[model samples]
Target: MPKLLLAGAGHAHMAVMAAIPELVAKGHQVTAIGPGERHYYSGMGPGMLGGTYQPEEISFPVRDMVESRGGVFIQDKVARIDPARHVVILDSGHEEPYDVLSCNLGSFVPQGVVACDNQDGANGPGAAVASRSVFPAKPIEQLWKARQRVHELTRDHSIRVGVCGGGPAALEIAGNAWSAGRENGGNGCVVQLFTGGKLLRNMPERVCRLAGKVLRKRGIEVVEGSYVRSVQSGEIHLENGKRYVQDVIFLALGVRPSPVFRASGLEVSEDGGLLVDQCLQSLSHPDIFGGGDCITFVPRPLDKVGVYAVRQNPVLLHNLQAHLEGRSLKAFDPGGAYLLIFNIGGGQGILYKSGVAFGGRAPFWIKDFIDRKFIKKFLPNAPSETH
Candidate 1:
């Protein structure tokens, strides 16, 4: 049997877990390595913040899911990959060799871009610090923990909450934060959204207008052309010389590719993501496959969206199986258009697809249904299914 190693318990890898029984039946031994035992669904993150869902509702225990399907689950962070030797080095200094390897490790927030205070004050007074007041909205689990801190802070004081970034995720975070403040009886909580450029640049103009209207109605200030320079204690300094006082700051800046790829000597994109071809196989190393936020599809540049990652699951699985069987692999076609639904809180959502955009309770319901269906597939008691 061929030993197959899977790295990262991300959305793309979820498909592999769902197909584990089939893979094992075909005489392939599968092993998964990741830092955490649970996989948090980013789709439900905003809903969780808005008090629409509980934490357990948005995540699943990864080990149980993989183990139940007859796969070995290794709970450790992959420190590096030695492509030549087909070995993956764990953070614990242990190495695992494999016949084939697949990576779906998600991205992380770039460090030192926004200075945070060092514990020893070695960086100087008023240095920006990633203390309890600063939150990076990635790695999902950290964001959830930070939300708890935000809840506690708002419970006793009226603080200015600032969110940086103009993407759909940032907009959703702003909306949910506003709703959370209201629900916590902190109506006096001032929410400010700072975008370095136009809001929802990737969406249609009508979508942008709708989002602006919603933010206005929610009393969240929108600051355009305010590129963040650095964060200091209780303040965010912008490149335009405008300073905003925010007791709590949420970084909605989308993630950059994990640095592990570059360190492993894999050919990576300018953004440091592992570069892969249409088949999702590494351009430099044929035996390696990758998808999700960790890979840059070389056939055509793709938006780093969850939809793209989820859509690539089947292709990834097929290619993996084909590679193991010594058969021809199938190319993956990333469709030009995919549904994008932004939960704007208050039981409302904005939906955009192929230049058309709409928002209302109807869209929110549609999004809720889709999210629930996706989560249901991985539930322990749910029937086995693949997206």
Candidate 2:
């Protein structure tokens, strides 16, 4: 039996966790490592920010889920990977050897935008300033905690909230933050969304118009056609020489791939994501596999979205088992046009796919049903599946 080591409890890895029993029965030893015990479902992120769901409601306890299936779970981050020796080095200096390894480590916000000094003159005077007030909307937990900070700060005075990025996450954050403020006695709070390009660029123009309408209705100032050049204390400077006053900033900027693979000499995309073949196996090292946002499928590059990751779960599992049993591996096909539902807060959502867009209460219910169904599959007794 080969030792299978799963790195990171990301969306695809959640499938592996749920199938641990079957994998164990097939004579494979499974070990999983991640930085935290819980994995937050990104789909419900907007809901959480809007006070529609609690932290526990959207998070899955990865440790308990894996351990219940007779697999070992390590709550630590991967510091490095020694591909030559097939060993994973932990931040604490421990090493674990494996016969096969799969990584689904999620990406992070670009460090350049978030790395600021904690003290005076940390990044030098007049340089881009980053303080505790800046928050990145990735890794999920940090964003959840940032919401608490926003609530606390808004308890006394109205603050200007800035959100960067043009993707669905950014739109959702802006709406949710505005809703959060209004519901929490900060009705006069101001919200600004800065996007380098048009908002919801990936979606159809109709969807974009709907999103714009919703944001306008919520009084979110959408600054388009320019990106943020730098952020300083109490203000954000745009590339177009425009300045916006902000007390707190939330970055919904897209993620960059983890550097662990690139540092290990693995074949990686220009963005530093692991390059994988059709079988989801590493192009440079076949013994290694990767999925989710950490990998770029060479033949058909996919957008860094959770829907693709969720779809890859079954393919990854099939290939892993095939490799162990010397059977033919299956290729993953990311078909064009998957359903994208954006939760716009207040029991409303927008649905877009294949250039058709619609918004109504029905889309919100659909999104809620789909999200709850996904959570229930991996989580036991998941709050009776309510919309």
Candidate 3:
């Protein structure tokens, strides 16, 4: 039996772990490595922010799941990968050998956007001064800390929050902030959402408009058609040189592929994503496989959303098993028209898919049900609650 090294306990990897029993039965030893006890479902993240679901409801025990499969779960980050030597170096200075490697290591939020100049002039004299206010919304713990910091900062005083992104997460954060503020003390806090392009650019215009409307109706200010050039202590500089004051700024501009893999000497795309072929195998190495946000299939443009990773699980599993057995590989194609539901806080959601849009509490309920179902299926049961 060949030993498989699975790096990153991300959504894709978690899905693969849920089916690890079959893989183990097929004569393969799977070793999972990631630095987390729980895997939080991104779909329920918005609901979590909206206070619709508790944090525990969104996260499942990955440590427990891998143990159930009788597989080794090393809760450590892969510091480096040596493709030629077929070795993965861990952060703790341990090394592991792999017969085959599958990378679902997820991705990192772009440092360029987060560390970009904050022209607010509050931090320093320079006009292009970078703000220390960046909050990278990956690795789960960082985002959790950010939320905690925001809550602590806003507890005693009226706060003005600015979210820097037009994506679903930004909208969800803005909505969550507004709803939380309203519940605590309406008008005392202000939630502002700023976007570089129209919100949800890939989605239909009508859908974006409806989303904008729903946000506006909730008293959340939506700023569109502009990029935040820089941010200062209490001000945000727009690309047009206009400045808006903000007490708190969220650097949720966008997410990019993980830089760790690129640092490993793999062939990455121009956009910094792992270059993978149709079968989701790395172009540079035949023994390695990759999927999730870090990979890009140029022939078919797909969203870096979690759904695509989830959909790719079966194919990844099949192709992985076949590759190990020296059988023919199968091709996996991502379909068009991704179904998206954006949580607008206050127990409401805006559904958008294939140019149609729907917004209501019913969608939120459906989303909640779906999210719970997913968590129930993939979450590995833990021995005890440590968190």
Best by TM-score: 1
Q: Count clashing pairs, candidate 1.
A: 4
Give the residue spans of candidate 2 off by over 4 A. 115-117, 124-130, 380-387
Tens digits of per-residue lDDT for model 1, 145-209: 65676678778877688988888888988887777776757544688988899888877899999
lDDT of each: 0.84, 0.83, 0.74
Clashing pairs in 2: none
Rank by TM-score, descending? 1, 2, 3
Tens digits of per-residue lDDT, candidate 2, 151-240, equal 888888888899988898898888877777766576346889999888888778899899989888878888888888777665677888
Best by lDDT: 1
The alpha-carbon lDDT assigned to residue 264 of candidate 3 equals 89
Runs off by more than 4 Å, candidate 3: 113-134, 184-188, 381-387
**Worst ten-residue run, lDDT, model 3?**
121-130
State the number of backbone clashes in model 3.
Answer: 1
Each prediction's TM-score against the native? 0.94, 0.93, 0.88
Score residue 370 of candidate 2 by CA lDDT. 92
